[model samples]
Target chain A: MDISPDESIFLHIGPVALNATIVYTWITMAVILAISWLGTRKLTSESKMSRWQNLLEVLILGMKNQIRSISHQEPDKFLPFIGTLFLFIAVSIIMSIIPVYQPPTGSLSTTAALAICVFVAVPVYGIAKHGIIGYLKYYLKPTPFMLPFNVLGEISRTIALAVRLFGNVMSGSIIVAILLSIAPLFFPILMQALGLLTGLIQAYIFAILSVVYIASATRVHEEKEQKFEENRKGKE
Target chain B: MLINWFTVFAQIFNFLLLVFLLKHFLYGRIISAMNVREEKIASRLQEAEQKMMDAEHERDLYFQKNKENDERCAGLFASANLEAEAQKKELIENARRQVDEMKKRWNESLREERDVFLSNLRKRAEKQIYIILGKIFSDLSNTKLEQNIVETFLGKIKSLDHTERNHIKVILKESYNKAVISSTYEIPVEQQHIITAEIGDAVGETVEIRYINSQDHICGIEFKVKNYRIGWNVDDYVKFLEREVNKTLEEELAG
Candidate 1:
C-alpha cells in the first residue's frame, strides 16, 4: 500500500514518504493557480487570453461548447466538474519532470474515484432535469431487445475511460523514468519534453471524454440517436 | 508522490464549495445587469422619437395660424375697396346735377333782361313820332286847318291804294313829307346824304322851302330829306330804335 515516488531514496514518516513528488507538486499547483487567475481576469466573449491563460480557457470553453453541442440543455451547469477534471489530469501528468517525481493520474484507484463521481453526478442532474422515473427509462434502450447490451456498453465505456487515462499516463511516466536512468543526460530532457506532450494530450482526452459520457447519461445522446433514426426512416 | 485519501477528499470538498459560490453570486448578477442595460437603451430611443413627433405637430400649428391671419388681412382690403368704389360713384353723380342746375338759371335770367330792353325801346319810338307830328303842324300855320284836320288828312292818304290819290292829298294839304309812295317814284337823290361823320360832322335842321339849313343847334346832323329835315331828328331817331328792336326780337325768338 505504501508508494515511493520515482524510485528515489527518500526519508519516511509514519505513512508517507517526503520525496521529489512533494516539491514538484507544490510547483505544479502554483503554476495552475497563477494560470487560472490570469485566464479569468479579463473575460470578453470575442477575444482570446494569452499563453497559460489561453491554455486554461481553451480547456474550459472546449468542454463547455462540447457539452452544449451534445445536450442542448444548460451545459455551463457542468463547467465546475469539467474544469476540475481538466486541471487535475493536466497538473498530475505535468509533474513528471522533477527528479524522483511521479504523476498521481497513473493510479487506477484515483481514475476510478473520478469516474464514480462523474457517474453519480450524471444521474443527479438527469433526475433534476427529468424526474427519477425519467432518469431510469434511459437505462432501457429504445429497442427492448438491445437493453442488456446497451446497459453493459454504458458501464464498460465508463470503465474504459478511467483505465485508458490511467494506463497511458503510467506507461509514459515509467518509460521516461527508465529511459532517463539509461541515457543519463541529453536523452532524459528529450524524454521529459515528450512526457510533457503526452501529459497534455492525456489531460485533454480525459476531460473531453468525461463530458461526452455525462452528456450520454442525461439522455442527450439518446435524443440525438432517435432523431437520426427518424431521418433515416424518412429518407428510406 | 503517494496517495493521501484525506487530502484528496478535502480537495473535492473545496472544489464543490467554490462552484456553489460562483453560481449564486457572480453568474446571476452579471446576467441581470446585461438585461437592465438593454432596457435603458430601448427607453431612451423611445423618448427621442416622441419628442421629434411633438416638434412636427408644433410646426403644423404655427403654419395654420399664419394662414388664417393672412386670409383675415385680405378680407379687410376687399371691404375697403368696395367702400371706395361706392364713394367715387356718388361724387360723379352730384357733379352732373350741379352743372345742369347752373345752366338752367343762367338761360332764364338772360331771357328776362332781353324782354325788358325791347319794351323800353318801343315806348321811346312812339314818343318821337308824336313830336314829329307837332313840328309839321306848326310849320303849316299860315295855311292851317287845325292839327286834327292834318292828322285826318294823313290818315286818309295812307288808306288810299293808288299813288295818284296819295299825291293829290300831299299837294293840297301840304303834308310834311312830299315823297311819292309808288314803286315807280324813286327816292329823290337830294333827300339822301352819305354822312361819313361822327357827332363832329353834324349840322342842324334845314328849311324845305329854300332847300337851306335852318337851326344850327344839333351837332353832326345832316338834312337827309328836303321836305322836313329827316336827319338826326324824330324820324331818324325812330328808325334807329325800330332796327334795334327788330334785332332784339330775332335774338329772343332764335334763343
Candidate 2:
C-alpha cells in the first residue's frame, strides 16, 4: 500500500509526473473554489441572506476572529494565507471519508509545501511592515552571537511544522488502513471518525501557529510605532 | 521518497493560487459588505437623533407659545372685566339721574294740578255763594237781592272808622273828586241816593259818584277811586272762606 498519495503515479511525461497527490490537491482546490464562487456570487450587505451565504460568512468571520485573537492585530492582512491553510487541510482530511479517497494532506510533499508557504509568509509580512533591513535585524536580537541560532531555530521550526502535520495526517490514514485489515467493520469506522476530529484539530493548530509566527515577525514594528508615538507625546 | 520536489512546488503554487482566488471572491466582498452595513446603521442612528432633537425643539416652541397665549388671555380677561365694571357703574349712575329727573317732573305736574283745582274751587265757590244769597233774600226777606246788596254797601260805608273815612277822603281828593261805584246789577234811584249820601257823610266831601254796571263785583257793590277801593261783595267773604279752607288743608297734610 502506498503510504503517501505521491507514490501513486497516474501519468508520466519524461521527468514530470501526475500522481494522486497532485490530482487530489486539484480536486480539493476545485471544491473550495466552487463553494466560494457559489457563496459570494450574489453577496449582499443586507440582513437577510441565504443559508449558504450565512454559512460562508460564519466560516470566514470565525477564521478572522481566530487570527485576530492570536495576532492581536487586524485579521484582514493574515486572513487569506491562514484561512486557506485551515480550509485546505480540513477539507482534504475530511474528503478521506469517501471510499478510495486519498487525503492530499497525508502526503509529506503537500504538508512541506504548506509549511514552506508559512515560512516564507512570515518574513514577507514582517518585511512589508518593517522593511527587509528592519526584519532581518530581528535575528540579531539579544546579540549578534545568537544570530546563527535564531536562523537555525527558524529553519528547525519550519521543518517541525511540515513533519508534524504530515505525521499526524499520515498516521491517521495508516491506522485506519491497518484497522480495516484487522477488523474492517466497527474499528475502521471508529478510527475514521477519530481521524475526522484530529484532522480538524490539526488544521486549527496549523493556522494558529502560522498566525503566531507571522505576528511575532510583525509585532516589532508595532512596538516601535507605539514607542515613537509615546516619545512624540512626551515631547509635546 | 516521501517528499516529491515537483509536487511540493506544485502544491505551493496551488496553495498560493487558492489564497489569491479566495481573497478575491470571499474575504474582500464579505468584509466590504459588512463595512457598508455598519456605516448605514451608523448614519441611520445619526438621522434618528437629529429628528428627535427637532421634535424636542418643536415641543419647547409650542410650550412657549401656549404660555404666551395663556398670559395674553388672562390680561384680556382682566381688562374686559374692568371695562364691564366701569360700564355697569355708568349705567347705574345714568339710571339714578333719570329717576331723579322723573321725580322732579312728577312733583311739578302735581303742583300744576293742585293750582288748577284750587282755581276751579274758588270760581265754583263764588258762583254758588252768589246763587245761594240770591235765593235766601227772595225767600226770607221778601226783598230783591240788589236792594239787600245796596243796603249792605251803604251800611259798610256808614260804619267806617274815622281813619278809614280820612283815607277815603284823601283818595277822593286825589281822584279829582270822581269815584266809580260799580255794582253787579243796576241799583234803584232811592238806594243809589242813600249810598251817595252815606259815603259823602263819612268822607265829609261831595264825591262825584259815577255808577258803573259791572259783573266783577260778584253780586255786590265796589266803590273805587283810582287804585283805592272800598266795597261790600260776596268776593271778600269767599276769599276769607278760601283762606280758612287752605289753612285747614295745610294742617291736615301736616298731620
Candidate 3:
C-alpha cells in the first residue's frame, strides 16, 4: 500500500509535479471557498439567516472564541490563519472515509508547509506588536547566554509541530492500509473512523501550539516577567 | 518517503488564498450585519423612551388642567350657593314685608268697616228712638194733654220777662199787628179765643190771629207773624229731648 498520496502522480509539468495530495488539497480548497461564497452570497442582516449561513456563523464565532482564549489577543487578526488550519486538516481527515480518497494531511509535505506557515507567522506578529528591536531583544532575556537555547527552542518547536501532525496522520493512514491488506474491509473502515479522531486531535494541538508561540512572541515583556517569577518560585 | 517540494509550496499558497476568500466573503459581512442590527435596536429603544417621556408630560399637564378645572368649578359652585342663599333671604324678606303691609291694610279696612257699621247702627237706633218717642207722644195726645200743653204755653207767654215782652212788642209793631197760629191738631174755638185774648194781653196790642192745622211740627204747634213768631206746642219739648239724646250718644261714643 502507498503511504503518501504524492506517490500517485497524475501529471508532470517540468520541475514541478502534480500528485494526488495536490489534487485533493485543491479540491478541499475549492469546496471550502465555494461553500463560503454560496453561504454569504445573499446575506440579510434584518431577517433570519439560512440554515447553512447559521452553521457557518456558528463555526466562525466558535473559532473566534477559541482563538481569543488561547492567544489572549484580538481573535480577528489570527482567525483566518488559525481557522483555515483546523478546517483544512479536519476536512481532509474526514474525507478519508471515501473509498478512493487519500488525505493530503497524511503526507509530510503538507504538514511541513502548514507548520512552516505558523513558524513564519509567529515572528511576523511579534514584530508587528513590539517592533523588531523589542521582539529580537527577548532572546537575551534573564541573560545573554540564553539566546542560543531560545533559538534552538524556536527551531525545535517548529520541527516538532510539523512532525507531530505528520506522524499521527501518516500512522493512521499506514495502519488503515495494513488493516485493509490483512482484513480487507471492515477493519479499514474502523481505522478510518479512528483516523477522523486522530485528525481532530492533531488539528487542535497544532492550532493551540501555534497560539501559544504567537502569544509568547507578541507579549515578550509580560511573559518574561511571568517566567522570571516562576523561576524565583522554583528556587524557593 | 514521498515529499514533494512543489506540492508543499502550492498547498501553502492555497491555504493563504482560502483565508483571504473566507475573510472577505463571510466573516467581514456577517460581523458588519450584526453591528447594524445592534445599532437599529438601540435607536428604536431610544425613540420609545422619548415617546414615553412625552406621554408622561402630556398626562401630567392634563391632570393639572383637570385639577384646576375642578377647583374653579368648586369655587363657582360655592359662590353660586352663597348668591342663591342671599337671594333666597331677600325674597323671603320681601315676601314678609308684603304680607305685613297687606295685614296692616286689611286691619285698617276692618276698623273702617266696623266704624261704618257702628255709625249705621247708631244712626238707625237714633231714628228708631225718635220714631218711638214720636209714636209715644202721639199716643198720649188726649184732649186733656192738649189743653195742658196750651195752658203751659199760655203760662209761658204770660211769664215772659220785660225784655222778651219788649222784643215781642217790637216784632208785633214791625208786623203791623198781623199774626198766624199753626197747630199739629185742631184746637177748640173757645181755646183759640182764650189763646188769642191771652196773647193780646201779653203783647199789649190788638192783634189779629189766623189759626192753621199743620203736621210738620210732629205733634207740636207753631205760630207765625209777618216778622215775629210766637207759639207753644209739644214739638219744642220733643226737639229738646232729641237734642239731649243726641248729645248723650255723642258723649258716650267719644268716651
Per-model TM-score, in order, reads: 0.45, 0.70, 0.62
| Candidate 1 segments whose C-alpha is farther than 4 A from its true place | A1-63, A95-101, A143-147, A221-236, B1-255
Q: Name model 2 segments beyond 4 Å from true.
A: A10-15, A93-101, A172-194, A221-236, B74-255
Candidate maximizing DockQ: 2
* Proportion of native contacts present in model 2: 0.93
Worst 10 residues of 3 chain A by lDDT: A43-52
DockQ per candidate, 2 decimals = 0.05, 0.70, 0.48
For residues A116-188, could you state the per-residue lDDT of candidate 1 as single tens digits?
5666677777787667876676666566777788778767876887678777877777776688668878887
Model 1 iRMS = 6.0
Worst 10 residues of 2 chain B by lDDT: B106-115
Question: Each prediction's interface RMSD?
Answer: 6.0, 0.8, 1.6
Better of 1 and 2 by TM-score: 2
Candidate 3: which stretches are off by over 4 Å? A177-194, A220-236, B48-255
Q: Residues A1-236, candidate 3, lDDT per residue (tens digit)?
A: 67788888888899667898889988888877777777778776665877767777788888888988987878888877788888888888877777678888888889988988998998898888878887788888768999999889998999899889988998988888888879996778888888889888898888888888888888665677578779999999
Ranking by DockQ: 2, 3, 1
Put down candidate 2 lDDT per residue, B152-252, tens digits, no spaces.
77778888899888888888888878898998888878877888888888899887898989987567899999888878889888889878877886576
Return the TM-scores of chain A for each candidate in numbered order.
Answer: 0.71, 0.94, 0.91
Judging by DockQ, tell me the better candidate of 2 and 3. 2
Ten consecutive residues with minimal summed lDDT in candidate 2 chain A? A220-229
lDDT of each: 0.56, 0.88, 0.80
| Residue B74's lDDT in candidate 1 | 84
